[model samples]
Target chain A: MAQIEIRDLGIDYRKPKSNEVFSAVDSVDLSVEKGEFVTIVGSSGCGKSTLLMAVAGLVDLTRGSIEIDGKRVDGPGPDRAVVFQEASLLPWRSVRGNVKFGLEMQRWSGGDLNERAMQMIRLVGLGRFSDYHPHQLSGGMRQRVNIARALAVDPEVLLMDEPFGALDAQTREIMGTELLRIWERAKKTALFVTHDIDEAIFLADKIVVMGRNPGHIKEVIKVDLPRPRNESILDSDAFHELRKRLRAHLAEDMSSMQLVQEVA
Target chain B: MIAEFFYRRQALVLGTLSMIGIVVFWQIAVDTGFINPFFISTPSQVAAEFKVQFEDGSVATNVAATLYCFVWSLGLAALVGTILGMLAGWFADVESALEPFIWFKYSAPTVAFYPLFVAGLGYGTPTIIAIAFLFALTPIYANTLSGIKNTDRDLARAARSFGARPLDIFLRVALPGSVPVMMAGLRLGVGRALTGVVVAELFGANAGLGYAITYYGQLMQTTKMMVSIVIVIALGVLLTQILSFLETRTDSWRVDSGR
Candidate 1:
């Protein structure tokens, strides 16, 4: 059985400037098996984050429903945890404190809370910096804490909206590799959103290409490359071929709106 | 030492120079009888009188009465105003419902209403405390309501996502988030209450620093009157500094995102 099933999900929000109804996310349907890692890749303002918010139940659904393991997504619950792009950590808390905060909310008690939090801190390669506050952490280290905080809850569905989006290219690549290593051990269902096609290809079993200007899905290409993926995989024929196909698809999609071609 | 001196030197030097100059001028004036020693008491005369008052235990009763009024007004107003403000901030309808009463209490000349206080509560410690409470409440109410209202909704939503119930959101997120703002209110409140106590005591009370000023001034003991005024001002400054120090220490966990 599918661990999460999202059917014809739609989200509408107020445009901040004026009195106009707009769709941030339009009719979309997707499903994730219990352990499959899916990545949604899109341009900026493509409503990929909004889609993640819908899955997390932070935003209201205008149409359709999402079921997490046969239970409908009502208001936000502990079962689904989200990692925001900006590492929305509680600044007052230390690394361990932030990680343990979820467990605290879940009514965890005794040394188990500390033990569980420490383990996750170690998992994120932040064990040495356990006592450091979020303000003391670098962008990469903070994102690591963000990921660890999400995983600490032992959530079934991990929703990440470009968690490493703001890091430098080098740091982002390192984090991508680190994420795969952690995901393999945890084996949690993930729905990650990123603008980087390479990041999507490297992290996801299924790369969902999204197009903005009404926010619609462009393609959903399944990456056939097997697990424990490495940098050498980027040079492989299959990886190059898949990247070529997606690029062609994006280029063709952009051809109709060729005014952007000059800039691209 | 040089860098530190340069960093603070101008203000420090000016302050020290002013202090030295005032003392020098005061000593010379008293020696030359330039200013009447009885009316404009030099700092030395006041200090000597303070020592006399201290030895005789006269300062204690006045100090105690002033402190009692301070504690009464501060404690009662803070508790009532803060709770009411929290409630009003939490629920919009409550804010609107109580707006008139809160506004009236805030804007109406509390000092002019001194007669009403004396009429109802009588000219005693309670009346003085009541006046202080009235002056102190407006800031506490306004700041508290704003503090709770201004708590980041994003954090509240984030807490809610983590299975935080309404109580948890209020206690952990809203209340802690409101601490800095609430502390600002408390600082303003203490200052206002001190002023109120002085006013009420002057008009209604037979003892306390305000009474000391009045009792001495009526007998043309200007030096004693100035001494009482100085004591009240010093008390205000001391209390403000202590509360502000506590605020900085306790709310250090918070980020002032300027939100």
Candidate 2:
């Protein structure tokens, strides 16, 4: 059995001002293996983030179920940690403190909490910034702290929802590279959600493409890239081929999105 | 040499110089007969009266009485406001139930109810404390409510994803996040509660700085009255300064966001 199995999962959200209930995710089925790095790519409102949130047990399912280690997921647990789109560090805490928040919450008795947090901070190359507050760091640095905080919990699975979405292109690429390096070292199952195609192909073992209008997976493309991938892969033929295929899928999604917009 | 010292501590030097200048100017004006000392007493006269009051122990007694009421009022306001505000912020029903009453107390002239308090509790420390408590309660409640309500949703969400229970979220996330705002509320409460204590003393109290002010004013002893006024002003400044110092210390982690 897969490490994390999501079967026919569905989620619905009620309109804030209205009583209307609408589906956000529907009939979604996906499974992640142990230590696999999977990326989900889609346009905004495609429910890709919603799917990730469900797997993280942050959202309630309207239908179907999600299971981890053959146990049905109910609510957020210490078994998985989520890296939010925003590096949601507590403004009142230093980098080390933010990193230790999850461990403190879990009542983790694995070792000294401060030592574990410091180790994760150093792993993310933020050893010099252990005492810095969230606001003192740059956007890239803040996201690195967020990643470190998630990893500090020593979770079996890591969920990232566009962890670098708020960053510039150059910074985003750098973070992506950095993330893969961290993932390699941590060796934990990771589900990263992003809209950047190159990012999807570069870091992912398999890319799950999602479509909106009651969001569902359209396809899952297995990335054939070798290990220890670097920036040079962006200039390679195989990378271009995969990028082209992903682009085609997105183009199709965009046109369909425009049609839905016109209909609305 | 002096310029270097002044530049190193400009604010401190300037503030001290300005205060000394004002007192010297006032004394000079009174001595030169440019201003009437009978209506607004000279700085020296006020200082003399202060020394006399200090020696007689009336200053100490009155100050202690005023401070006693002020402390009780502010302490009760902080405790009750924080508890109620937390409930109001966390539960929609509690907030809606409190909304109208809180707004009413906020906008209404709270001092006008002093007569009612006097009738219920009788004139003295109880009445004085009640008035001051009313004055201080609203700001503390409002600020704590806003602080808890405005706690960053992202932070709470992050905490939740880490398996933090509701109590954990409240204690670790919401309480700490709300500290800066709650401290601001306390600062405002400090001023308002002081005002309330003095106002109550001015009307019905037998002791306190406010009573001293009224007594000296009626006797046409401007220097003595000015002594009490100066003490009140000094108390206000000192309390606010202490709170501002605490605010900065507690909020040390907050820096201007680069993003």
Candidate 3:
């Protein structure tokens, strides 16, 4: 059975002033088997993050259902953990404290909790700076701690929404490499969302391309590139061909979206 | 060595020198008959009165009474104001309910209502404490409301996504997140609370530093009146310093944010 199953899920939020309901995610059906790495790529308003939020049980489903490990999700649960784009570590908490946050929320106790948190911190290569607060660290280091916090829960599904969106290009690539290395060991079912096509291709086993106006999946392309993927893959003919394909799909959607906008 | 000390501590040196200069100038003016000693007490005369009041222990008693009223009223106001403000900030209905009264309390002359408090509480320490509490509550309530309202939505959402219950999110995130601004509110409340205690004591009570000031002034004992006024001023400076120290320590995380 798939670790996560979303069957025809929809999310509608009411506009505060207009009192009109707008659909953010419409009829989105996807499933992730255990230990699979999936990425959703789209434009700004494509509802990709909203879809991820629904899967994490942080948003109300307007239609259908989300099942995690064969159980319908009611609200946020210990089985799923989310990593945010801004690396929202509590400013007052040190690196170790931030990593321990999810475990603490899950009512984890004993010395093993500390052991698990420290191990994740070390996995992310933040061992030397465990005692430092979020504000003291660089942006990339903070995102590493953010990843560590999500991973510490030993969740069945790890949902991430542009987790490295704020980092510089160079730092983003380094963190991406580190993330893949970390995933090699922990191998939890991962669903990542980003607009950067290179990032989606590099990190994902299968990339789900989404389109905006009412937000639904457009295509699901399998990334057949071999792993362990490194910077060398960027120069390969196969990698270039795949990147070209993804770009064409996205550009076609963008032009068609602009045409619809002009008519409306 | 003296120059080095003076250079390193310019503010302390300048403040001490200015105070000494004023005292010397005032004493010279009175002794030379430029000002009447009976009407305007010299520094030495005020010092003598302070010594006499200290010897008789009236000064200590008055200080204790004022300190008691200030501490109790401010402490209670801090607790009540923060809880109410957190609720108002967290829930829209609570905020709406409090909006009108908060505006009224903030804008009205709270000291003018001291008579009503004295009428109900029967003119004693309780009345003074009540007056201080009423005066101090507005700033704390306003700041705490804003603090909680302005807490990072991302952090709260992140906590929620981690299976944190509402109560845990409040206790662990909202409360700590709002603390720096709440401390700022408490600092503002300290000044208003001092005013409250003085107004109530002067009008209704026979004890406290405020009463002592009025008592000495009515008797035309200019030196003792000056002493009491000095004590109040000293107390204000001391309390403000203590609160500032505490605020800095509590918000040590803000050092990196440069807030």
Candidate 4:
């Protein structure tokens, strides 16, 4: 059984004055098995992030339904956690405090709560900075805290929207590896959305390539490359071949969109 | 340790020196007859009046009165204003309804309402407190409202996604996030509260610093009047320093918390 399932999902934004409905995501069907890693890659306006939001129950579906653990999603629940592009750490909280925020909201208590939060902080390599505030840490460190906060809740599914999009190339790569290491340990189903094809390939068991013009799925590609993935894998022939194939699909999707526009 | 101490106390030393310089200049002006002592009072004369007031217990009574009024009024203003402001800030319809009145209260001369307060409350500490509460409430409301509005939506959304209820998000995310601006509003309100106290007492008050200043000034007791005026100024400076100390603590939290 799928951990998360989206069938014919659609989201529309209606202008308040004109009442003209614009489709952001239309007729998208996808599913993630338990412990599977899925990445959605698309250009801007492809509604990839919107799809992730729907799965996280942050967005109301204009049509169809999303089911998680074989139950329909009505609103946000503890079964899933989302990591935003920005770290979004509360300024008044230390790193450990921030990690514990979700747990506190979930009514978790006792000494084990602190112990679990500290374990998550250490998991993200922020053991020393657990007491530090978000501003004192580097951008990468902040994102690490953001990830730890999500993971600490022990949610069955993790939804991430360009979690490392704000980082520099070096930091982004490093975070990607760190995320895999943590994900391997947690073994939770993950649905990640990003515009970076390399990031998608590096982190995903399967990649869903999205396209604009009503934001529909263009293709779903599987990464045949072996893991545990490392920097050396980027130099491998299989990685290059996969990268070329994903790029070609993206380019084709763009031209087809342009063709549709021209025909109209 | 000595160097660190000096660095920490530099502002205190400078402030004291500047105050001494002003007193010396005032004394010179009075001795040379450049300014009449009858109108302005010499530094020594003002100090003597202060000593006399202290000995007779009038200064203590007036100080207690003013502090009493300030504490009650400012405390009420902070409490009521923050609650209403947070509600208005969190809810759209409440904000829209209250916005016009808030702007009117903020822009109008608060002193004009003292006469109305006096008429309603019948000329006592209640009247004075009403004036202070009226004047001080607006800044606290405005700051909290804007602070709630300016809070990072992403943070709130993140909380919501983690299954945080509305109240939890408001208390944990919105309230703490709004503290910096709320403190700023309180600072503004504190100054306004002081003005409110003076306006109320000046109109008709039995025993307060403002009443003392007006009473002595009308009788041409320049030294006595100067003593009251100096005390009022000192109170303002002291209150501001205490608030500034609070602001610095919040500042450290902001810097480290990534706010």
Give TM-scores for every candidate, taking all chains together and pairing residue i with residue i.
0.89, 0.93, 0.92, 0.93
Off by over 4 Å in 3: A109-111, A256-264, B1-40, B255-259
Instruction: Score candidate 2 by DockQ.
Output: 0.72
Query: Residue A55 deviation, candidate 3, in Å?
Result: 0.7
Worst 10 residues of 3 chain A by lDDT: A255-264
Kindly list the per-residue Cα lDDT of model 4 for residues A1-264, writing each as its tens digit: 777888998999997999999999999998888998999998777999999999888999999999998899999988988888765888779999999998888776546888999999999899999899877888899999999999998899999999999999999999999999999998999999998989999998999999886989988888877778887888888888989988997887767666665456
- Candidate 2 lDDT, tens digit per residue, A1-264? 999999999999999989799899999999999999999999888999999999998899999999999999999988899999764889899999999999999899999999999999999999999999888889999999999999999889999999998999999899989999999999999999999998999999999999988999999999888989889999999999999999998889888766666567
Residues A1-264, candidate 1: write the lDDT tens digits. Answer: 798888988788888889788988787888788899999987776788888888888889988899999999977877888887654777777899888877777676546888999999999999899998887789999899989988998899899988888999999989999999999999999999988878888888998888766677888888889889877787889888888877776675566455665478
DockQ scores of the candidates:
0.39, 0.72, 0.61, 0.67
Give candidate 3's error at residue A40 in angstroms.
Answer: 1.0
TM-score of chain A of 1: 0.92
Model 3, span A123-148: residue lDDT tens: 99999999998888899999999999
Chain A TM-scores, candidates in order: 0.92, 0.97, 0.95, 0.94
- Report the C-alpha displacement of residue A185, candidate 3, in angstroms: 0.7
Ranking by lDDT: 2, 3, 4, 1
Error of 4 at B182 (Å): 1.6
* CAPRI grade of model 2: medium
Candidate 1 residue runs with Cα over 4 Å from true position:
A14-19, A109-111, A230-264, B1-39, B255-259
lDDT digits (tens) for residues B117-210 of candidate 4 = 7778888899999988998999999999999877789899988988889899889998888988898889888887887887788888898999
Name model 4 segments beyond 4 Å from true. A16-18, A109-111, A252-264, B1-19, B256-259
lDDT of each residue in B3-42, candidate 3, tens digit only = 9999999999999999999989999999999999999899
lDDT of 1 by residue, B42-127 (tens): 88778888887778887888889898998899999999989999999899999999899887886788888888878898888988
